[model samples]
Target: EDQVTQSPEALRLQEGESSSLNCSYTVSGLRGLFWYRQDPGKGPEFLFTLYSAGEEKEKERLKATLTKKESFLHITAPKPEDSATYLCAVQGVTGFQKLVFGTGTRLLVSP
Candidate 1:
């Protein structure tokens, strides 16, 4: 069976604070890991795609890194505008790469 879990389902940060969100998973055959950011009532916005262990990607204040069993999203100096629900998803090496998504981490950055 495949499963995904994210920790600290919600986080509150003051402006300029930094934190890391974790995404843990168990799967049969790993193909890729994906990170997305979703604003209220909106579809997810693609952030990164990690293919293998030691792979990493970054944009602006966000950095995503992957391991064999988990992945992390590191936010640097977060701002109030960065408040959103961050989602993690995994794709297996079986059949069209179907994705399994974790309950998102709701981040609140207050000014």
Candidate 2:
């Protein structure tokens, strides 16, 4: 079975503080790793997709990196507006449309 585990279930940061969130996974064969952001009462918003190891993507204060075993979401100089639940998911070669997801890391940024 494919599985994902995210660390530190929750994180607290001061405004402008930087940090990285971890997503570890085990799959039969990795097709893609996905990153998402979700605000309270809203659906998750797609952030990045990594297809191979050493691949990276970035937008504003957030950067996503993928490796063979895990992925990381780096937040640089985060602001209160950047706080959200960050989710990680993966699609395995066996299941083209099936995604296994971690519970997510809840990030709270205080000014």
Candidate 3:
């Protein structure tokens, strides 16, 4: 059963605080680990593509790292405007890009 589950469900952070969010995945074969940031009214925006354990990517205050069975999204010095839904999806063995997404972790960054 290919699936993804995010922890905490929601998180609250004060501006300038750093925190890490978790995403666990279970699948037959992991093709790629994807991290996306979704705003209130728009589709997810791709943040990172982690291919293997120890792989990581970063942009501004967001950093994403992947392992065999899990991924972590770390936010540094987050701001109120950074509040958004963080979604994690994993690509399966199938050739198609049918990424199974976790429910998402809603983050509310307050100033």
Candidate lDDT values, in order: 0.93, 0.95, 0.93
In order of TM-score, best first, we have 2, 1, 3
TM-score of each: 0.97, 0.98, 0.96
lDDT of 1 by residue, 26-94 (tens): 988888889999999999999999989999899999999999989999999999999999999998877
Best by TM-score: 2
* Candidate 2 lDDT score relative to the true structure: 0.95
**How do the residues 37-99 of candidate 3 rate in per-residue lDDT, one tens digit apiece?**
999999999989988889889999999998888999999999998999999999988858899
lDDT of 2 by residue, 47-94 (tens): 999999999999999999999999999999999998899999999999
Each candidate: RMSD to true structure?
0.8, 0.6, 0.9
TM-score of 3: 0.96
Candidate 1 off by > 4 Å: none
* Model 3 segments more than 4 A misplaced: none
Q: After superposition, how far is residue 67 of candidate 1 from its true place, in Å?
A: 1.0
After TM-score superposition, the amount by which residue 20's alpha carbon in candidate 2 deviates from its true location, in angstroms, is: 0.2
**Inter-residue clash pairs, candidate 1:** none
